[model samples]
Target chain A: MAGLLDGFLELLDVLLRNRVRTVMTALSVAWGIFVLVVLLGLGRGLENNVRWMYRDDAVNSIWVYRGRRTIPYQGHPVGERLRYTNRDHELVEARVDGLEKISSRFYPPIPDSVRWQGKIVAADFRAVHPDHRYLENTLVETGRFLDEADLLEKRKVAVIGVQIVGTLFGDHPPIGEWIDIGGAMFKVVGTFRDVGGVNEESQIYLPITTAQASFAGADRVDQVMFTIDDAHMADAVAIEDEVREMLSRAHGVSPADRRAVRIRNNVEEFVRVQSIFDMLAAFVWLVGAGTVAAGIVGVSNILLVSVKERTQEIGLRKALGATPGSIVRMILAEALLLTGTAGYAGLIAGLLVVEGLRRWVPENDYIRDPDIELSTAVGALVLLVVAGCLGGLVPAWRAATLDPIVALREE
Target chain B: MIRLVGIDKTYRVGAHPLHVLKGLHLTVPPGELLAIMGSSGSGKSTLLNILGILDGYDGGEYWLGDALVKDLSERKAADYRNRFLGFVFQSFHLLPFKTALENVALPLYYQGVSRKERLRRAAEHLDQVGLSDWSGHLPGELSGGQKQRVAIARALVTRPRVMLADEPTGALDSVTTQEIMDLLKRVNAEGMTIVVVTHESDIAEQCARTVFLKDGRFEGER
Candidate 1:
């Protein structure tokens, strides 16, 4: 214990004697850690942006599309265009296990313009079941969405997007007002906003029953969208296969026909995106670690020069009965002090910057709340200590192996 | 108590080997003050290094208090040096960053002495060397004689069996050299075995016994 204290004192004395050089070496390490942490935080920020993009819709939802048949089945020729009816939706809902909420949507063949008074604005028009609002992440800004009475009674009630309301209604209230669509007047029941920005918000939603009865001319749906239970989300691919088989049988299409049906599972896509972010995180760590390694090499080189400069002092200590181990300990302790102190300073500074960004930076599409993981901070500190040890090893070995007689003779 | 039989040391300068010490034999009994004198390149420093265990001999049998000091590990050699030998150099060799008391306490530190006890004993040694008031002063603040005196106190603080002084007063004036030699004489009177290596005949005359070296071999003893 006494020897340890003496070694610490010796290290302190040596560092105090070379304060400028010591601080410079320490700053190099500090800058390395700082760059690493900031890069990692930026990486995390980008990942968070991707996650936020999926916030508007259920990550576990799946969208199934009707395509032309690729396989002939039971007198049906290959390349026959497939169409989905209400029966297919009912069949899949009855047969597919772990099915959460399901909705079918139909869109007009051409862009439709909504007319209120003398103003007319071109907008997207989609007719969907009442469950579509929940599946599509439509947050009602005013009034309420279409209910069972609207779908069941075939009521002529329309829910308008906020952009649509802004474009046609001006300063007047949109709800309870009549909007003309294709010469048919429908009452505007609600105004909704989509998380997907203005593009998604410039649309109008009406009941599928009303659209099919009034314009589509038959029971036809362009797409079927549904979500799976949280517990079954991991098996999203299998659930999609089951859904495709059930729909194929109902629509008289071959199950083996790849083009007959298309399943876009958001759960699977979310998982894939998560893996991509994981790889990105790993890459950031590699770059950060490389920077830290370079800093460690810088420290090692400086320590080697210091050992060369202190040849006589080392010789005097050796002659005064300091063992090789003591000499090595002294050098290592000095290195650890330099790296640990400087690295922590960098860590705190980086964290403060991250916190500052989180608190003050305005929200943008590409980044939000940039910060590093707790484990990453701890790992960086550990790296600093290990790097310090590695940085000291070569110089300490050189000092320990120095022959006292030859060293004393050095001028 | 020290002994050396057929000690040999050689230095390889470039491709040629310079034989620094050749089959040298010497002994210093307890409480004896011995001086080794020689001109430059006569191997006096090399012989002194061998006696102080600061350098290894190419071939020799060295005994310090019945322990054979041959081919010892660096750790064991350091232990032996700390336990049995103290050294003073011509340049004082005090670490410039340390206060005089701290420098004097260094050898005791390697001996695992507590800081309080080491400082206390170091203070006593500084008082003995008449540098008690300069204990807190750094080496840069001290005069040549005072620095040499602090170096001498450092050498004595560990209470080693043998004190080796290599040109202990070579950098001092004649008066300071005489004062250092008088201090060495007083230390020797306290039953401490002392060996002073110098090229000065006057310094050699102050010791109880004097040995002269020429071309790496002892010429005669007076």
Candidate 2:
């Protein structure tokens, strides 16, 4: 409720009186804020990298891989491990409540030499269910996804990705063309365009029945993937466990032998990764807060010295009948001026550094480009003001509590 | 009017206490010009500090106008100083950063006067001290005598009941010192009480009465 203009003018006067001190204090604050922003940006970049690794895959989908179990049976460890059959997949599909979409995969162990027209191309072929379109998040740019009719009819048809088409046909419209896969002819039912190389576009896909009869030759499948509904993560996990129990009972495999049948839940993976990122962010904040505290300490030390040097001036004012409150305000104003200026300077310098790094640095390299977000700027300003106030309080108290006679005698 | 009865002040250095004012008694009616002449360590500055309410006294009954100056709290002491006392230092403590006009207006500012009124009064006081033309000049830009005139103008701007000058002419030349004394005399004749502290007998002779101090007690009245 005091005269704000007077306080502001007085603050300007103190800062002007000690230009070097003021600038130094401001620089420290600015550097502190800069470090904080840079740290946050680094954390965000790391999170982005992790997300990039999982792109083209369902974040909400779970995969059940074929694994081996090492358990003792009859005083010797069991060998070769148990294998999953189609019946286990069917049992889970019937009982699991949160099954949004499901797909099974079977890869041919040997590579296929495919021939189109007069060209030959190497292909690692797989037979995947049609629901793979949903689980793999694919877009059929040129043609369309394989239908359930294709699976039931057991047709000798192929869904070829754009890369395979480029390798085999070479600028030719490949649809309806016959391709020779391991001496057997199959029609290219669809040609797929590029979908970031991480999806079904990476290879050739055929009917599960054809793949089982041809290259892989074994009747057993390789893996199954289930995409769960986003809203059913918590309840679906427990239900998935029940489905696993049912499948284990049906397959007559021990529940403890994980190799018999392996199950994964995306919600669990998401929770684990989320916690790791949280911890990383907390560590970054710790370092940033420490840097900010160091800057505050530097400002406070300079302010204390400034107050000491101005003792005689304070005495003269008191002798002229300046109230204690005014003296306190004067010292506080000086502190605020020093810290606030330095904080803003630090912010600008930090942003400049971040921008330079962003422009000059390459992607996927060290030292992520800092983001000067609005929230970060506001947070830094608030921290600086608080630091300034705490820094000024002691010196201001001393000045306000000064005895005029003692101060005048301070030569 | 100012009156002092058995005012005592002591300073504690290390373990020993040095009494600077030993049961001192004095009085000065309105419009009187008085001087206290004392050598170094003879308590002249201490007495001035006590009278200005800038220092606390051990025991005393000091009154200015109808108010008791001694035994007042810090805030009230400040109020008393602002209401009735003005000071001029030998070093011309005119706040070197400010112009003469700004320095002269400070006391009135503390008195809560309007800025326009304070500036107008400060201008008049500067004209009285014959530094109307130097109002815009900082203390560093002015001569020693001109600085003293500014300081005198600052002291009198509030129209205090008493003006205290601690060796007001200590830093000036003989001619400038005479000029400052003449100004003080003119101000006293205009009905403002004045007390000056100086070791120079010539400066003391300019006032109507002079008191000499030795060993923390008044030696005799002159």
Candidate 3:
């Protein structure tokens, strides 16, 4: 009989007076959504960890390291070690299709050998081509990476990692400063960082041509690494085959010998890991939704009980001239209001927890920055509210359909 | 004005259909205070239910004013009850949670009256029942006689054409029962049409007219 607002106030009167029962019902609802949010956030954190693992290298790159041994093929000896040279790098550059950036890591046969101002900088050293900057995921902090001119001119310039600078330079200016590497002096041109972590940061980079000419005295390189263009990333396996065939033919080795040409198709590994995370994401949503559904069922069950307890009251309302429609409306409104408020409380609690994890836990090798999008959180809340209403429906209908005379029968 | 022609009602208890009311005819003229007396199992409650539109009759034409109220849907029945009939139960069914004022205002609420006007008219009705100061009290806080007065105020708030009381004093002691009958008589003297169903001779004798129900049919008029 009341207006919408008055009816709503009446609903509050009933709910608020039965404080313990209402809170108990709402608590179950809150717990359900709470589990959903926390689980989703942790899943996102795990995915972030997986994504962070790939920061070590460009996800689309391919690597061909020095082969172990080749099968005897076409009059070649069976146990010959497969050696890659400058010619192998050149042949791939000319013949490979859709190669974006190519480089070679030419080790100079020197170990534990970099020092400056008589201080052992304790760094790994790599003699690499100009594009090794991109192939190795290098972020230059100061000055610049090795360029084509640096390789062509065989300049003795080095790009040291940031950690290397702190050790070798010791607060002195590093750019254009001279550093000792196995009795040779190379001028530092830049300092850099790598997502590959502190170990990569403590290493050093130098021109490949200079190392080949100065140290090995031959066109020897340890590895050829390259990233493919976005257009060809999907066809990476085919390109790997073409490169392998050409390299085996050029080096006089068996094309079918897998060990002769040691190739690592990073794209395949990345895609495999990516599909795993995708499946994990789907699972998280399923579990979260199931939990929310359980909460909705709880809401429905509690409301059904409420309707049962108020049967005589409903009959009294009926006898007092309230239409069945109005009675139904009143109960439905109560259900919606209960769910809306409880769902919102759970969402806010989840967001606060996620934000707290982000601030406190920060970053780790796994589960970095546990967080969820605001839109996703709100979307979850709305979904729970709707499902809650459906849960309330059976009871509301029961209340409306009761025969007033029977309902009001005195015991 | 109210009229009933050949009214019939039946109840089925676990595959056994019990006939509660036979074909019966009655008419209540405008502004007449009337009583219907019957013992238990005499179908007085069933008759009141049919009259109040809280239950449907299996057969009959019921005319409240000019409208024939038969085979009415629950919705239509509720509308008729809200506009035409007000009920007072023996148990004084004031909603336990609402204040006395809110209970009184409920009938007006069914009429779609605004809250302010519903409150005003409800307050006036409480004043008429001599319980205006107790309007803010919940039913749990009120005495037996005071609760019945609140029920009366709720019934009268909509200014219904007919006030129906089902053993309105059945739950009260003798003194409180007399106090309630006095209030009903004062209401009847104001020219409001009223119908009360009871078994007590004293209650019926106080009404303007009385009818007796034996089984389902009217036996005689007094």
Candidate 4:
């Protein structure tokens, strides 16, 4: 232990004496680690941004939209348009296994304006069953969402979004107050906030039955959305095929015509996005490791030059009773000191920069706070240490194998 | 304490091999102050290298004390050298980065001696060499003779059984050479086995015995 301390002190003095060269070599390593860490953080941020896009919607939900028929069935013309009705929603609910929650949405044909206490604001209005709240990850801020009784009674009740409340009601409490929508007066049952964003927040919702009866969309829905059990998410493509078949048979369209029935499976989209991010993460690691390897190579080159320059000194040490093993140990210690110090500096700097950006960057729909995992940071550190060892190996071996006689003769 | 019989050494330069030492025989008894004198290309340095265990011979039987020193592994050779030999080079090869005291203590460091004990011994050796006050100075800051004294101090701190000085005074002025020779004589008086390799007759005359090498073989002894 005492000998090791003495050797370390000697190494420190040696490094201190060649401060400029040591610093330059260390800076190259630092730059490499810094670039690697920063690039990884950026990659993580991009992945987070993609994930944030789905935060407001059910990841397991699938959306079926009405499309023009591309294949003729039951004597119907191929070009006929298909629209989903309440019966189709019932058919899907009864036929599809692993169904979690199902809801059909109808949007009014014309843009509607909402009025409360003489204040008015243009809003995008949609009519939906109560399960739409859960399917869209909508949070009810005040009062309750539309219930099954409201849908069955065809009650004239509405759920207004926070943005609409801000626009029409200002600071006024909106619950139990009457709001006029497209010449129909409905009592505001609840206020909601959509995780999607401000664009989604400016909309209003009503019970599907009431909207179809009151407006011109009687018994008709433009979109049907349903979530399945998460256990079935991996087999979502197969489940989507089943749903498509059922829809085709019920609507008198050919099952083979993909374009005739449009379905958007959020489970499949999430899986695709997740795989893409995984690839991106792996790519980031590869590039980062390559940069670190380059730095390690630079360290190795510097140490080789150092070994060459110190040939006579090494010879003198050997003459003074230094073993070949001791010489190798000394060289390896120097390499570790250089790389470890520089790598940690870069790590701290990278983390600080990431934190700074996270604190100052504005929140948007795509990106939230950008940062890397703790395990990744530690992994980089371990890689740097290993690289440092590798960087020292060849030079240390050369120094160890030096012939003391020839080395002394060098000067 | 040292014996070499029928030693042979060859050097490879490109393709052709040049024989440097051929069937050389020499011995040094304990506590002897001996010198080997030769001109350039006379294989005196090669013989010194073999004696110092820095190079291996092609064919030889070398006995240092009770151990046969031929074809030993590098680790064992280093151990033998550390335990039995101390070397002083022509240029006074004190490490430039270390203080005189640290350089003197380095041999003990290789022996795994604690810092306090090695430093104390190094200081004692420096005092013996009349360089105690200069111990803190770096080799660059010291005069040539002072550097040589520091090197000698380093060589002595390990308390090896043999001291090998290769051209120890070659780079010194006449006055400094005389001073160093006097120091070596003082060390010899204290019962140290000292071998000085040099070409100058005056340096050789300072030793109790001088051997002349002509062509990788000893020609005569004075």
Tell me how each candidate scores on DockQ against the true complex. 0.48, 0.34, 0.62, 0.53
What would the per-residue lDDT of candidate 2 be over residues A43-129, giving only the tens digit for each residue?
666676666656676777877776555554334345545466676667668777778887778876654667877688777677878
Q: Would you list the clashing residue pairs of candidate 3? A: none
C-alpha local distance difference test of each model: 0.86, 0.78, 0.86, 0.87
Which regions of candidate 3 are displaced past 4 Å? A1-4, A59-62, A70-79, A86-102, A108-135, A143-159, A164-190, A203-220, A226-246, A254-257, A264-283, A361-366, B10-19
The TM-score of the first chain in every model comes to 0.67, 0.68, 0.80, 0.75
Q: lDDT by residue for model 2 over B1-222, one digit each (tens)?
A: 989899898999999999888999999999999999999999888889888988778997888888887777767777778778989888887777778998898887677676677789999999999999999988889999999899889888878999999999999999999999999999999999999999999999989999999988998988
The C-alpha stretches of model 2 lying farther than 4 A from their native spots are: A58-62, A67-87, A90-199, A202-222, A226-283, A367-369, B11-17, B114-117
Q: Please provide, for model 4 over A343-392, each residue's C-alpha lDDT reduced to its tens digit, 9 standing for 90 to 100.
A: 88988888888888788888876456789776787677668767767777
Interface RMSD of each: 1.8, 2.7, 1.7, 1.9
- Residue A74, model 2, lDDT: 38
Q: What is the TM-score of chain B in candidate 2?
A: 0.97
Error of 2 at A308 (Å): 0.7
**Which is the better candidate, 2 or 3, if ranked by DockQ?**
3
Candidate 4: lDDT of A320? Answer: 69
